[model samples]
Target chain A: MRNQLRRPLATISVYGINLLHRQNPYVVAWWSAAFPGFGHYLLNQYIRATLLTIVEVIINYLTNINIAIVYSFCGEFDMAKSVVQPRWAIGYIIIYFFIIWDSYRSALVQNKLCHLAQLENERVAAVNLRPLEFQYIEPKKPWLAALYSFFFPGLGQLYNHQFALAFYAMMWWWIYLTLSRAHESVTLMMVGNFQESIAVLHPQWLLFMPSVVGGSTYYAYIMAREHNRLFRIEQRQFLAERYSHSEVRLFPR
Target chain B: MLVIGTFEHSLELEQALSLLEHDGIARKHILVILMDTDPKNPNQFLSKPTDLYPNAIEVGTAFATACAVIGTSVGFKLAWGPIFSGLSAAVGGFIVGFGLYLFVKKGIHKTRSKRLPEICVIVQCTEEQVELVTETLWKFGVLTVGRVKEPSLRA
Candidate 1:
């Protein structure tokens, strides 16, 4: 039973074992506020992020929170207050604050650990090859990653092998498109039915798209650049160990 | 005597280290600091985020968020409506913000890398052993070598 119950914290696919680095607590908290699970996701706390994301979605839908937020943003406070299911919404409030605090505290602790780990200077296996997966330290261009993300919200993450985030963003992008009727609205607008285009859009859902797209693109670009640096560090460690032994010769014929 | 030398991080340098060890120099007395000049490792002018020195994640995220919010707000009045207008603005804003970030970061990174040692090897030994260590280093195509009678400053 113990053996069967065992689980790995991170893997090459599900959530890669990211390098330790100082992450800003405020940034992590801000992301949590942006989307409950996002801060935990950045911290590489996949399990928590997944759970929080599910709960957030369920609660948001049941409480009509998104609709309420839309009304609130549009300055219809009475409608906003009326649309929300008080009980469900109330439960989410605590979780929202908890996640922000949780992610912030976790980041601070993680930063300390990162400092210790760097001081230790332990070498890592730069290459991992398996029948199903190939992960290696290699150079990747930030610009190219950004371009891919610009084309689609998650393709850049996909390129970076950030499978969990890539898939998550893609799934949400599709959902956003469907709920907002963004494509349909664009089509209507293109065909000269401006009024119909405007009428078709769900502004609440559409508003979420900008932040998600912008964030994803920026994240992908930064990750690419960072990974390149990691590759160099890992490669340097490898070379020092592997190639530091050689015989000297005074003169060669 | 302390023998200090810098090499281009190649096989010859490794050979020199091995020869020094074979010449009865203890491993602990020999130090090697490798330079990051690998051909495959690009991004020579940018570095990973770390404690004091870091690539700012918040700046990009905050900039992107701000752009996204503004774009979305302005889209309410545009002809393409909110969807297309907001998206374009978000992307445009992200590019400008991130690019500006990289420009500043690159300058810092370039200077930091310049200060990094290039395949430096420091050997500590007595006056009697200096000749052997120096001979071994020179035989293997070392870049530059110097000797110090006494060590001082940042030992």
Candidate 2:
């Protein structure tokens, strides 16, 4: 009688566990807010998210530069007149949709992950079973890894013995920041202030001026966002190290 | 030292204690481990495995509480010097603690514990006879058993 009763109870508990394991929408929401298509990437729909993020970023850059260029040439009042350009309004719409869609996609993915997690938990709980065992090589100290990254981005991953990823992150960011500083300096040397340049430069310089201002602004934004992401990576590393329960053990010779 | 219990908010050491009564776990048994004070555990509650662990409960609670307090105080505290200053301090403290917690939790809790395979067992049962093995190993209270699950994989 006891066994029979327990079996049904266990089944119900398993079901509940499955339900509880569903992915959370909060993560998607957070990611979308953090980076345009980050939520979609989180959901494993990588290609779409990447395309959307890239397109939206490009459009955003163009629009921002256009606004700045117009202001530089004609002042704030002329911003209204500049809207008639071929793709400006359309670009705005695309960027807006991308942001909204990314957020929505993130929510959907979280919900799915949650459900899958619950189902898995329920299946395991139903059986009087133990977790399977195997040898695990714990990563090196997580906090130190993170601290390394914090002081010098990507160094932590190297310390944790992930040399390839460390090298990539470091190389990419180094190139980016260096290039960005160089570009900014050149822009100042060549053009002075955007608004002032519009007043001073001859018609020959005018043609290139718009593209220059626009490119610099967009690149700056991208670099800043990337820097933020790297900083967070460090934070992540430290947390993993301090909180992880992995331990090193010695085997008999 | 074994640390136990966590506050719903990162209050001052004294304030956190005031919120909860002493339960079976003696006050001395539990330490209010501040992430700020301990540079080693900079992001104590934020990352993967630890974020999902049961031990992270207090850290989460503290962060949530801090967010609530700070968010609520945004508009009202702009009036006077003492009130504004006090609120500002509280907000600053909470933000720093909560940011560290969030960063740690998000980074660490990204993986699911069950999906990954990481366990080891070494039991010497060959020498024992069948009856002894069944009795000693299978018995409810015979051999000591332990489990280690990746907290990051948790829901």
Candidate 3:
């Protein structure tokens, strides 16, 4: 008697809540905005919603704090106020929009996924489905290429016999390193350590100057050498191992 | 749990169970292990649990096929750098392979809550849920439903 009455009451409560869920997406969205992922919890998607909330908050907090630190150091409060806070505030707003967009999209996706699962269950019950099947595919070797790229950006690509890619990567790597090195040298020269700048400034021995000539050359060479070593590994792998069909099947034969 | 060997078909599973049954192994003593199936051709199946159970196994041929096709397409597109394209293809292959496995596991866990096994069905639909499924089944009609988890493993 009492048990029967309790059962219907419990069911009614569940139905009432579910009805609320379907009726107002805005309520869910509002809760989510108020407290990261509250909407997801309401929708019964706890994990993804929680992760999104945590990541968004942490990223926002970190970015804001970093910007605040930069302003604090600038010392001029009025200048910092006009420049820093608004810039950071705009960034924060952008981040918030991104988070909102991602959350809304993910939530809708999860809802569809859940509905599909429910339908699948119903179908399984209604029809005779075949047992689950398993098809094997061999693993691909990326470490070779990754390592190759690491040594000599272009060399590894070249060793893989990817002449054009190797050339492009190498050219870009060279350009970046050269520009950075030149910039570093100029900054060092501007520091004006007197005797050190004088030693490098004389044209007669400019080739031997520590600041202008030898500076950044070693670093550039090191970067280039490192990229080369990486490519060597790819060369070795291509020669030594017989890549399985699935591994190279994505390419041609 | 006492994993009844990894077999490709339900009929094979039934056969293995029958062998144990004939050897005086009680029905309660057996656990039908659903090993991870191959990602490419999910129905083709494999016996290696370590390989199959990895978190990255995909369930269909579509993803891998797409990857291979894409690699070939990219290779043709960049005819100037066949070698570099090949390397890219290799990396892409690994990603697609690992991706399939993750996708399937995620799909399974996502859909698990809606399944009958996950419902925690009460034996009498009245008794509190016992820790084991057999106990609940016994309450319904299966008198000899055996314990198949931790205790069965010990035996």
The fnat scores of all predictions, in order, read 0.22, 0.00, 0.00
Worst 10 residues of 1 chain A by lDDT: A1-10
Over A105-213, each residue of candidate 3 has an lDDT whose tens digit, in order, gives 6556544554343333211111112244221111123345434554455554444333443464466455544533423433544664433432322111111111111
Query: Could you tell me which 10 consecutive residues in candidate 3 chain B have the lowest summed lDDT?
Result: B118-127
TM-score: the better of candidates 2 and 3: 2
DockQ for every model comes to 0.15, 0.03, 0.02
* Pairs in clash, predicted candidate 1: none
| Tens-digit per-residue lDDT, A157-229, candidate 1 | 8888877778887888899899989889989987888878977887667766665665576667667766765
- Model 1 earns a TM-score of 0.68
The residue-level lDDT of candidate 3 at B79 comes to 32
Give the residue spans of candidate 3 off by over 4 A: A1-84, A121-253, B1-155
Tell how far residue B82 is off in model 1, in angstroms.
1.6
What TM-scores do the predictions have? Answer: 0.68, 0.33, 0.20
Which stretches in model 1 have alpha-carbon errors above 4 Å? Answer: A1-17, A247-253, B1-33, B36-58, B70-80, B88-155
Interface RMSD of each: 8.9, 20.0, 27.9
lDDT of 3 by residue, B23-134 (tens): 4444443323222223342211121233333223222222322333234223323432222343355456656666767655553443222112211111111112223333
